[model samples]
Target: MNEETIKNIEDEKFRRLTGVKRSPFEKMLDILREAARLKKAKGGGKNTLILEDRLLRALEYIREYPYLFPYKSKRWGQ
Candidate 1:
């Protein structure tokens, strides 16, 4: 519901799935990267918006399905 509650749940599930903790920076990056990818897919002169919608859903799924969350390419909080 609320952002903080969602964040706590997200963190818990993320750690449970990946066996590691996620940081604020990583979360922000994930949100930003996912946004950029979807925007480009939509505005880059393509008509297949289904792919864009699927990418958006995949990003949302990444938020819920923590195991699918990729490891941060850079170490966070280290």
Candidate 2:
């Protein structure tokens, strides 16, 4: 989901959808953003997905299929 979609969601609904409260989600996003910045500084290749999208995808994967490796999943290619 995009930032606007996330912004319109109520706190409880967001928690239900992503399995984490808004505060923690933002905190996680901050960590991911820092990592992305560092990777960029190291000359890492650009990612197609933005940081928020990447974090959302990871959260969805964990919540929907906890046992599967993200890279091994068919949806990962998307």
Give the Å shift of residue 19 in candidate 2. Answer: 0.4
Q: Which ten residues in a row have the lowest lDDT in candidate 1?
A: 69-78
- Per-residue lDDT over 1-78 for candidate 2, one digit per residue giving the tens place of the 0 to 100 score: 789988999999988888899999999999888888888888967788878888888888788986676566767774
Model 2, global lDDT: 0.85
Give the worst 10-residue stretch by lDDT in candidate 2.
69-78
Off by over 4 Å in 2: 67-78
Which number leads on TM-score? 2
Instruction: Compare the candidates by lDDT and give the number of the best one.
Output: 2
